[model samples]
Target: MRWHKRLLAAGAVAVVALTSAACGGGKVRGAEDSPQPGTSLSAADATFTYVPNLDVVTDWDPASSYSNEIIAMENVYESLTRYNPQTKKAEPRLATSWTSTPDGKSWTFTLRSGVKFHTGKPLDAAAAKAAIERTIEVNQGAAYIWGAVDKIEAKDATTLVFTLKYPTALDLVASAGYASYIYDTTATTDDLNKWFNAGHDAGSGPYTIDSWQKGQETELTLKKFDDYWGGWSGQHYSKIAFRVTPELTTAWQLLQRGEVSFVQRLNSQLFAQASTTPSVQTSQTPSFQNLLALFNTQSGPLKDVRLRQAVQKAIDYDGLIAAIKGSGVAASGLVPGGLLGNTPGMTPKQDLPGAEALLKEAGYGPGGKQLDLTMTYAQGDSDQDLFVTLLTSALDKLNVKLTAKPLQWTTQWDQGKSKDESKRQDIFIMYWYPDYADAYSWFVNVFHSAEPISFNLSYLKDDAIDKEIDSLPELTAIDQPGAEKAYADLQNKIINEQAAVSALFVQNYQRAYAKSVEGYVDNPAYPNVVFVYDLKPGA
Candidate 1:
């Protein structure tokens, strides 16, 4: 568990597979048949209710599914070496032990024994290979995580070896992170599209999707595995239902009335109310999500670095905080604050005069033509609307006209698609939730020059920064102080020298739960998201 900022700056977000299997069931009966006046229901038939942020989860395929928000992962699936949120370390889960060559290219993993899938099949090295290969074959949203994968072989039934095309820690951590959950290969079908979409997911975890209706609700039912090789992470519930409530008011009411047992996030007002409610309890975790206003560096007036810098400085981050009226504060860097490699001392400052000066240097102020920039924000989001109003007032001072465009999330995604000036975004407000708890997940995917326009919305490239980013893994491998220094240099370059981004505050996700629910662990590694495996009914 290397929690040190320097060495852990480069984390693993491999798009590989890590499977979990278990033993027989162990159910303990409770006093009441149903829940008492103020207690949890019987463990055997327990049910927890929730209001999910999403209307529906379109895909259940681990290889292709791309969701940055709350997702149902641990209960139904498992990974090789997951980042223990509590320890901030990549600890064993599916794969027991691992070793890498001196070159760091070839790595071997020892599989856990006697772990059988719910499909009555044993997960072996071959299953591990198939999981990695299928993810590559789908070539969907998550394929970028496995770009460096050169070769994979099952040396034996219990031994899995992975070889990388280039030397980086990505491959080593790939099998333990994001797209790394292993499926029961024995029950899988060749037609991946039909297989995943048809709900024939051969995962080997504690729970399975009992039923789901599009745009309605997803009901997950659990059955304990008596033969589980590695025991469950925490308390487990028998049933959980996730329903979508688009309105915050409706979701809040549902939680207070006991219709829903828990909610993943709450508004500031709702959070205040929950703390005072008699039948409710509240908890919060500072979200690791990096919200930013991404500027398209490839096109439009922003192509000039000076203009970009001016725009960055023109927006008053402090003003944004005052307007929002919440627990949030200014961001340090692209990586989340309160976490390793955040570079806490560095705060994004508003340089009004400097902004005007930079703009004039780029011929964007004074006697220049009127500058009208289109900034997109989520429609129906009151907080965003308020922020935009403040933004417009600020930009008005510089004689820069700021046009606010309110859009739905799907439409925003459609707009994010290209270098085509027609489709490229000028300034789209968005957030980057790391695939894993690592600085590389943010720096590489969001800011890397090597990434495609889809991944790197900034469409920026710096040879100097690129060279430093490339050497991060080796730097960390060599020594801690040197790695920290290297990361600091890059963080400074990206935030100050490049002036490629204007960061927003780190979010603090507030969750509300019914009085009967307990043992809910808010893993900051996954931000505000929750999995039923870590939560169970309580008195």
Candidate 2:
């Protein structure tokens, strides 16, 4: 996500003043304001606030939805299994431990003794099986994650067994996110599904929903779950407050005023100013995000591969970076650099001559015909505007007329997937941040033709590409070298075919907090994984 620094910097002083009012002069002397040193809180005491960019969360339903709101919801909800940021491994959350058959096609999990749901009902093996089954039976959109399951059996009150039709590496990753959150079976299936679909939320996590005012704020209180399998210790905060501030300037103001202890989504301008604030500290994490442009191949002139390739060649990536004025590397492949199968080197240069020739070959020339194109992006996102502006300027040099249309994030998302080809914009500028550290997570979901919600908005497909992706697991099972070779081959194919064009850029996650806040460290594996329990008042 690109943040415009100038806007943030200009509002920093006002934000700090506002934050002071919000905190009501509750000052943490030195780092002493941090939570009690070394004494961790149990589920009952831990709490904090997270300010998101959206006013209304589109999807909160775990089974069939996808959005950042789910990330915040994860704190209050418990999944069967959770990803351990420290270990980069999946660990038991609702389930105590799990085992897989030697053939890797079947598995079993044992629930912890005496676990209870937030509603005070006992969570037995039967309940666990029902939750997993409902995920498939009701939310078909999430079928890729749970549809492979052939059977789920309850072996008494404490044990659950799962049988899969095929081996899948996604089994663990899928369980760690909203895709596998366990819900109470006693509630109306429609109510439960509605909670997941709309912003209304219910979960078995450490926190419980206290109050949620859509597009404004969500408040949660730590619930003392004595029945929680994870032993509780003396934890930190007792409440969490999440606010939605779509304007970066407002978020910056809130942070400086102490209305919020921390602020994320910092751009270059905010980072620089926040770094100098005596009351604030700034830090960043390496992220698995890729900035790219999506071409609408179904209806636009971009339907011609040559025209698409020509447009790809016309982008001045370096110029775009300069416009943003930040520390981001130019991206060349769909998967950004530092990933398992990233194709090294900068994206091919803007070959103006080559582009012109390709356009001519595609029956478009200086006097041939002027193609009309519209580029759509999320409104209020300054970084996206920077990209669109730079690209439009470049296209102008190529004798192409481009119109820019900025829409609300939710509106743009809805239209981007509309079935009516004519209603969709000609081009889209967006980014993809991986859920886990895997090539398949990035490549398969985004490009695979089989994925119902394929991010491949381009609608590009190839049989060979499909076959190679399908055979990845088998190749990986045979040997590591073979798997590497297969992925490299895939990247090469994508580049050779001009499958999608993107400028590689440095992946970084930035956060700023008051000097009194402590225990915040960026996780390399999941950049967003900041355990609420880890926070304490600083000296």
Could you say which candidate leads in TM-score?
1
Per-residue accuracy of model 2 over 161-185 as CA lDDT, tens digit each: 8877765443464454445777666
Off by over 4 Å in 1: 1-45, 68-70, 101-103, 170-177, 218-235, 338-340, 363-369, 450-452, 474-482
In candidate 2 the C-alpha lDDT for residue 375 amounts to 75
Whole-model lDDT, model 2: 0.59
TM-score, cand. 2 vs. native = 0.81
lDDT of 1 at 345: 79
The local distance difference test score of each candidate is 0.64, 0.59
**Number of the predicted model whose lDDT against the real structure is largest:** 1
Q: After best superposition, candidate 1 residue 507: deviation in angstroms? A: 1.4
- lDDT at 14 for candidate 1? 15
- Candidate 2: which stretches are off by over 4 Å? 1-47, 84-88, 140-143, 156-158, 187-191, 194-202, 215-227, 337-339, 346-348, 363-371, 418-420, 450-454, 473-482, 503-507, 523-530
Model 1 whole-model lDDT (C-alpha atoms): 0.64
